[model samples]
Target: MGQPPLEAEIEIAATPDEVWAAISNVAAMKKRSPELVVMRTFGKPKVGRRSVNINRRKGFAWPTTARITRWKPPTNDGGNGSFAFYVWPTDVEWSYDLEPSSTGTRVVERRTALPDPSLSVRLTAKWALGGADNHDTELLAGMNATLAALKVEVEQP
Candidate 1:
């Protein structure tokens, strides 16, 4: 509606599988995420698994539990490793994707199904922040930072 989805993509010097390892490991993610304060597993990490996500380090600090709505491991369709974590009833889908690239690999994050930028969106523009920026500015910056850090972490020999 407002925008198809909030997508941020960056190319990292690494392989697709290597990138997947970084995204798949919840423990590692918690440790590496600059803003991620805590991540606890409620069950196994699979298609039907669930986990609690606590985001901090910014002016905002909130904890939310999400279910693994999709667990896909690069099967055709661009063969980009993809997974979706749903916070439930919010219509928001936090998605991750990885694809091989000439430079090395490309990582993408799509925070889709966000509330269409409408009357309510304009009303809460100042108070609500979705993608790094309150109205989405430094989102790609953060995504790039994560991808760069991830590339460094994965490309180590």
Candidate 2:
């Protein structure tokens, strides 16, 4: 079976459009993401756009590529909005969803590892990258950190 998606959420004291403005700058991810060392986009962030990322953990750094598959702007009323990308050279999809709330905006980050992982990818994730549970735990923490940083950025006056 495919691994369950890992997710984290945080409320930012900003509207959905404000939140989207901060998160949609995929090329600037390295500045906000705790684990992403670098990210470079080939074109504007939109469905079908490609990007490369380098992530680090415990002194180890690895590279991955991804293609944007979904890109939806927040509604004018500050309702739900989301964008997602599929990581290549592996079966992983990462996404961010935003929803307006009474306090401000709720931002959710998700990571889904495709169920039909190639043997090579599975082994790499299990052994080289730490076991599945360990990796998921780290990812959750990173997502929380990323969202917290973003909240601070968007809430600033």
Candidate 3:
């Protein structure tokens, strides 16, 4: 089987539009994301657009060129938000739902299983598992950290 998906949520003291603006910008993401050292794209990223995210400490790159599933603005209750981060071999889908309230906006990010990757999962089966180092656990932790940082950045001036 492919790698299991991870889910996380973070509340931001900002409107959905504000959060979207900050999160959508590749350059801006480099600053908001705790684990994402830097991200850049030759051009804009759309449905078939591609981008790269590099980890500073790991000194490794996790390249993903995913198609945008839902790019519509947030609904009254926050409904239309999802993206699939993919590597030719496999991909992870992240769907976000933001709900507005008196406090602020509640952003929920869900990492779901990739239906069928471009490549066979068997090729990297061994590396996919979370061994002693626990890559899977680490991924979730990183996601949480990134979301937390994002919340702070969006809420602050």
Best by lDDT: 2
- Off-target runs (Cα >4 Å) in candidate 2 are 76-78
Give the whole-model CA lDDT for all candidates, comma-separated. Answer: 0.67, 0.84, 0.60
Tell me each candidate's TM-score. 0.74, 0.90, 0.71
Error of model 3, residue 138, in angstroms: 0.8
Which stretches of candidate 1 lie above 4 Å from their native place? 1-4, 57-59, 75-79, 88-90, 116-135
Whose TM-score is greatest here?
Answer: 2
Which is the better candidate, 1 or 2, if ranked by TM-score?
Answer: 2
Please write out the lDDT profile of model 2 over residues 66-94, one tens digit for every residue: 89988998974447889899997767889
Model with the higher TM-score, candidate 1 or 3: 1
CA RMSD (A), model 3: 3.9
lDDT, candidate 3, residue 120?
Answer: 36
> How many residue pairs clash in model 1?
0
Clashing pairs in 3: none
RMSD of 2: 1.8
